[model samples]
Target: MTLALLPRYDEPRLLTAQMELIDQSFGIAMLGCSLAAMILASGLAITGGHPGALPWAATMVVACAIAHFGRLAVPDRLTEARSGRYARAMTAMLVLIGSLWGLVAWLYLDIRSPAVVICVLSLIAGMSAAALAVFSACLPVAVGFFVPAIVPVWIVFLATGDIAYLPMFLGTPLYLVVLMIFARNYARVARHAIALRFENLELISQLRDQTARAGQAQRQAEEANRAKSVFLASASHDLRQPLHALGLFVVSLSRTTLDAHQRQLLTHIEASSGAAREMLNTLLDFSKLEAGVVTPRPRPFRLQPLLHKLENEFAPQANARGLVYRTRDTTATLFGDPSLVELILRNLIANAIRYTRAGGVLVACRPRRFHVSVEVWDTGIGIPTAQHRDIFREFHQLGNPERDQRKGLGLGLAIVEGLARTMQTRVTLASTPDRGSVFRLRLPLAWTAPEEAADPQIAMRLDGLRVLVIDDDAAIREAMAGLLAIWNCPCRTAENEDEALALLDDFPPDLILADYRLRGHRTGHEAIAAIRSRVGRRLPAIIITGDTAADRLRNAHADGTALLHKPVVPGELHAAISTLMRESEWSRAEQ
Candidate 1:
C-alpha cells in the first residue's frame, strides 16, 4: 500500500475513545473509594460515633459516580444535562450533610480516634461531588467545579488528621498523578495523528502539481513533433515545385544555342535554383541536427581563402539587394571543423540579407584575449525581443508570415545554432526590430605567421579537370554532367558500380564524385573500393547523397571518403573538386 493510504490513528475518533477511557477509569476508582469510605464510616458508627450524616455522605459518593457514569453513557444531550443537574443537586445535599456530620463528630465523638478521619473523608467526598456540578468531565468547564471542590478539602486536611485519614490524603494525590500521565499520553497521540494528517494533505497537493507539470510537458513535446511533421510536408511540396520547374526550364534552354539575353535568363534561373536549394537544404539540415545526425570533421584550412570565396560569391547578391557585405582583416586563425564554421556564417549572412531591405550586412572578425569573435551585423528589419529566442526553434518564423516569406524555410538560425554547438563555439544575437541585427560567433584563436598565408596567385578554376560522376538518378546525372561541362570539366556519368568500373578501366579520372545510394543494393563505397583495388591507387572521392539521415553519414565515414550532402551547390562542387585534385596530386607525388 502507498504511504498516503496507510492505516493510521484518527484524531477525533481517538480523542472520543480517550475521553471514554478517562470516564470509565474515574468511575470505577470513584466507586471503590466510595465503598471504602462507607465501610470506614460504618466502623465509626459501631464505635457509637454521632454519624447520621456519615451514612448520608457515603451514600452521596456512590450516587454521584453512578449518576456521572449514566450521564456519560446517555449519548443524548438533554438526558445528559438532566443527569448532570441531578448529580449537582445530590452534591449540594451531601455538602450540607457532611458539614453537619463533621461538626457532630467533633462535638460528641473522640477527637483522637478514627471519627475525625471519617469526618475529613466525608468532607472531601462531599466537595468532590460538588466539583461535578459546574462542569462536564469531557469539557474544559470541569476545571472550575473541580478546583472549588478541592479547595475546602485541602483546608480541612490541614486542620485535622487521624489513622483512617492517611488513605484519603495519599490516594487522592496518587489518582491525580495517574490521571496526569494518562492525559499526557493521550494528548501526545492526538498531536501525532493531527501532524500526520497535515503532512498527507501537503503531499497530496504536491502530487497534483507534479502530475499537472508532467502532462503539460508531454503535450508540449507532442505538439512540437506534430508541428515539425507538418512543416516538413508543406516545405517538401512547396520547395520541390519550384525546383522541378526550374530544372525543366534549364533543360529546355540548354537545347538551343542561346544569345546573351537567353544566357542571362538561364543564369537567373540557376540563381533561383540555388536560392530554392539553399532553403530546402536548411530545412533538411535542421531536421538532421534535431535528430542528432550531424557530426564535425575537424581539419586545418586557410581561413583567408574561404573568406575570399564568400566575398566573391555574395558580393553580387549584396550589391543587387543594396546591402554592404564586408569582412575584417585579421591574422588570428581558428582551429575547428571548417565546414561547420562556413555553415554558421552562411546562414547568418543569408538571414541578414533576407531581413535587411536597404542597409548593409557586415562580417567582421576580431581577436579577443584567447579567442576570435566573428560578427555578422546587418541593418534590417531586426528581430523582436520576444522572437530572439524563438527564431532558433525549428520552423519558427517572425513578423508577417506572408511578407517575403518565400525567401527562406525559417531554419537558417536553427542550423546556425546547431553548427555552432557542434563546433564548440558560442553564438550570440542582438537585434532591434526594423533597425538592425548582429550575430557573433566566439571561437578559440589559432597560431598563424606571415609566411603561412595561402598563395595569392593560385587560380580558382576547374578547367580541363577530369571528374567521374556516379549516380542512380539519370536526370540528376545529366544535369550535373551538363553543369560540370559548363565549368570545362571532362566529366563521365555512370549508373552503378559496373558502369563506373568500366569507365575507370578505360580512363582513370583525376577525381571521383559518387552518389551514396546505387542500384542493385550497391553503395558508392563498393564501387570506389573496386576501382581502388583495380588501379592500386587511393582515389579522392566524395559521397554525395540526398539522404540527410544519420546512418548515411556514418556509412560514408566508414568508407573513408569525404562527404557532401545533396542537392549540391555549384560553388561547393567546384571547391570540393579543386581541393581533392590538389590533395590527390600531392599524395601521388609523395608516393
Candidate 2:
C-alpha cells in the first residue's frame, strides 16, 4: 500500500491533480467543520458546565473559516510552483485545526458526568470522520488531522486510570488505523482517475496534430495536380504552333507543280503531318478531361442521320483498305450530347478500320425500351480476354507492340471512355482473339421532332480577299501569309495587337485571324476585340489558338466569335473565314 502511494509522489502530474482535487473541496470541508465545532462547543458548555470551552471553540471556528477563504487568493491557473505552495498551506491549516481538536479533547476529559464525557468523545470521533472524507485526496494531510484529534483522547483515557476507559484506549487506535487505510485507498483511486484524464487529453492532442498534417498533404497533392495540367497545356500549345505552320506550308506546297517523285514525297509529308496533328489533338483532349472542363449538354436527336454521317466519314478509309463497310440505320431518338456521341462513334469506327485488314466493319443501333445502344462491330485482330479492361487505358495498345504511329496513338478507346463518362454513360467492349470486337455506347431514349435537311457543303473561295494575321511567332505569321497568298488572297501580317491595329488602319482587311496567346500577356480575343472597337464596327474575325487549356477554350467560346485551332487545316480555316464573312454581311444588311 505504501509502494502504491510512492508512484504518485514520483509523478508530478498525478500529485498536482491530487492537490487540485483537495483544493476544490477545501471550502466546503472547512464550512462543515466550523459549523459542527460551534454546535459541539455550545452543547458542551451548556451540558458539561465549561464556559471557557465555548470561546475557544468559537476561535477555532473563526480560524477554520479564515483558512479556507485564504485559498481564494491563489491564482486560477495552478502551475507546479503555485500548486506546491497551495498544498503546503492547506496541510498546515489542517494541522492547526487538528491541534485545536486535540487541545479540546485533553482539556475537557475531566468532566465528572459520564454522559458529558461520552458526548465529548463522540464529537471527537465525528470530526475525525469528516476530516477523513475531506482530505482523503492527500493521505499525508488526512493523517496529520486524524492522528492528533483521536490519539490525544486515547492518551487522556489512559491517564484517568479508570477500568471503563480501558476499552477506548485500545479501540481508539484501532479506529485510527482503519480510517488511515480508507484515506490511503481513496487517494489511490483519485490518482488513477487523474492520470487517465491527462492521458486522454494527450491522445486527443496527438490526433489533432495528425489530422492537420493530413490536410496539409492533401492540399499539396492538389497543387501538384494543378501544376501538371498547366505544364501540359503550355507544352501542347508550343508544339502545336510549329506543327500548324508546317501543315499550312505543306498545303501551300502541294498546289505547286512538282515531278512524280516530289509529289509522292509530298504525299508522305501530308500523311505524317496528319498523324502528328491527330496525336496533338489526342493530348489536348486528355488534358481537358483531366482538368475536368468538359461539360455534357444533352438533347434529343435522330440516330439515323448520325449513323449516315459516320458511315460517310469512315467509308473512304474502309474502301481504301478493301474492306466492306455497312450501317443498319434506325429512326431512334437518343438523349445525350450529340457532338460527344459522334466523337465516341467516330473513334470506335476509326479503331475498327485501323485494325481490320480483310474483313468489314458494321455500325448499328439497337433500341431498348428506355434507351439505345450504338455499337461498332469489326472482324479485326481481337483483344485478349485478360486485356479487355486494359484496352481503354491511355497509351495502351493491342498487337501494336512497336508503337507504330500509323496504327494510331492508342488513345482512341481512351478518349471514347472519357467522353462517355462526361455524358453520364459508359462504353463497353466485347472481343474474342483472332475473331472480332464490338464496342457499344448506351444512351437514354428521348422524344424529339425530326431534324431538318442537311446544309449544302460549298467550297469557300479566298481569292482576292483581304486578310490580317496576328501572331507572336514569326514563322507562323510567314507561313500563314504564304498559304493565303497561294489562295490568291492579299494578306497583312502583324506580330502584336498594336501592329495589327496599325495594319488595320491602312489595309482595313476583310477578316482578322489572331492567335489565342500573344506577346505582352495579350490574347487573340483581346486583339480582335480591340480591332473591332477601334474600327467602330463588328469585325469578321477568327481566334486561332494552339492552346488547349480549359480556361482558354471557355473564354473563346464565351466571346461568341469564330475560332480555329492551330496547326489549322487550310480547308477548315477557309470555311471558318467564309462563315464569319457571311454572318458579318448579314448583320450589316440587318442594320
**Tens digit per residue, CA lDDT, model 2, 1-591:** 876653124245566787778777888888877887788788778877788888888888888887877778767525665666666677778888988888888888774777767777887788888888788887777877887788888888788887877788788889988998898998888877887898899999988898888898889888886786677678888889899999988887888889999999999999888878888888777766765767898887888888998888889989999999999969888888888898889889999999998899999999888988899999999989999889889789987889988888787888899999899889888998889999989999997764565686586677889999999999899999998998898999999999988886689888888888899999888898899898898778888887877777777778888877767898888788787777777888999
For this target, which candidate reaches the highest TM-score against the unseen true structure?
2
Off by over 4 Å in 1: 1-255, 259-268, 284-309, 324-339, 366-372, 384-387, 450-470, 477-513, 518-522, 526-541, 570-591
TM-score, cand. 1: 0.57
The 0-to-1 C-alpha lDDT of every candidate, in the order given, reads 0.65, 0.83
Worst 10 residues of 2 by lDDT: 4-13
Q: How close is candidate 2 to the true structure, as a TM-score?
A: 0.81
Top candidate on lDDT is 2
Per-residue alpha-carbon lDDT of candidate 1 for residues 148-236, written as tens digits (9 for 90 to 100): 33444444544566555676556655643443344345445545664676688889989989999989999998988767556674555
